[model samples]
Target: MTETARDIVMGRIRAALAAAPPERVEVPRDYDRQPLQGPADVARFAETVADYQARVLRIGADEIAGTIAALLPVGATVAVPGDIPPDWVAGLATVPDDPPLSNAALDATTAVVTGCAVGIAATGTIVLDGGAAQGRRALTLIPDHHICVVFAGQIVDTVPQGFAALNPLRPLTFVSGPSATSDIELERVEGVHGPRTLDVLIVEP
Candidate 1:
């Protein structure tokens, strides 16, 4: 019968593959795996995080709830994961995400509070693995403001170190700073894809 356009394209693709040689390739991975020494450098990390235009506060464990509350506006509605420590957000107007909140509802919320899976001190990146305290990805993305509680113990020196502490199977979100992008003319805009304001509370023992 008739040779259709789809058939012609498939025939050409098959002919091209048959004429190509097959080979196996091996990738080189002899680079330095451990670049940094010891645990995360809190002072360096704070400085790097601040350079990104995000606020960083170092406080004792007892002051966590107060600091978080102070960072948020009065009467603000905060989206929180059910697994987060209750004392961390004590007396705050919080909506739990156990059943998962709708996008519209999350949009209406003023902020979101979460605990990160790991923090990369060298690059000032926060990694979230959709863990119990981190909740789903939508909860952190939809809010205008985000207050993340990061413990010193969870901080790592570099990206490689952070990766070593995380599981590849889980969903990962790495945040370096508040969502921002520059246009062709070099103008910068914030909160385009994520929170405009990121307040990182670095808790020490």
Candidate 2:
């Protein structure tokens, strides 16, 4: 309470602060160099993504509908966003994006396919912004199978690059492969939350 006591306290506080451990920091460069091999980079991205229980597939644009059908069983309802191209749902029971189907209903569906804003090549992250094509967050959460369509042009080289390309104000879901977690013994468990299976269709023009 006294001035001398206050000064001593302040000095002690300063000394404690000075003695504290330094914070670990990561220096983010403007441009992080990607792997020299282009094919290898893509393959590595897919491999790492699959490690999270995500099914990654590279296919031509015209083959999308068929691929979707293959991933989902017959008579299975598929949730398609309002802005999803018609061609994207050629051979499935297309569920409309209105009234926002219940989670229970979504669980009954075979798959939920939506468009992605960006796919990062460096970390194999798929980002959704709740855009017209991506639809609400529930669509992705409730469904067991999530087929995200990522245009080749939308793929970026790195995480920083992807962030710079997107608007932070938007509702964004950054998906780095499928959902998984580890237990006490570091035992891995997949699909406890979010989609258990994430199928990414990289649409190459």
RMSD, every candidate, angstroms: 3.9, 4.7
Off by over 4 Å in 2: 1-11, 18-44
Each prediction's TM-score against the native?
Answer: 0.84, 0.80
Record all residue pairs in model 1 with backbone atoms less than 3 Å apart, i.e. clashing.
none
Query: Judged by lDDT, which candidate is best?
Result: 1
Over all chains combined, what TM-score does candidate 1 have? 0.84
Candidate 1 lDDT score relative to the true structure: 0.90
lDDT (0 to 1) per candidate = 0.90, 0.81
**lDDT by residue for model 2 (1-205), tens:** 9999999999999999899967999997757444333422455566666766688898998999898889887688898787788888886789977768877888877788999888777777888999858999888887878999887777767776678778999999989877778899999787778888899887775
Error of 1 at 196 (Å): 0.5
lDDT of 2: 0.81
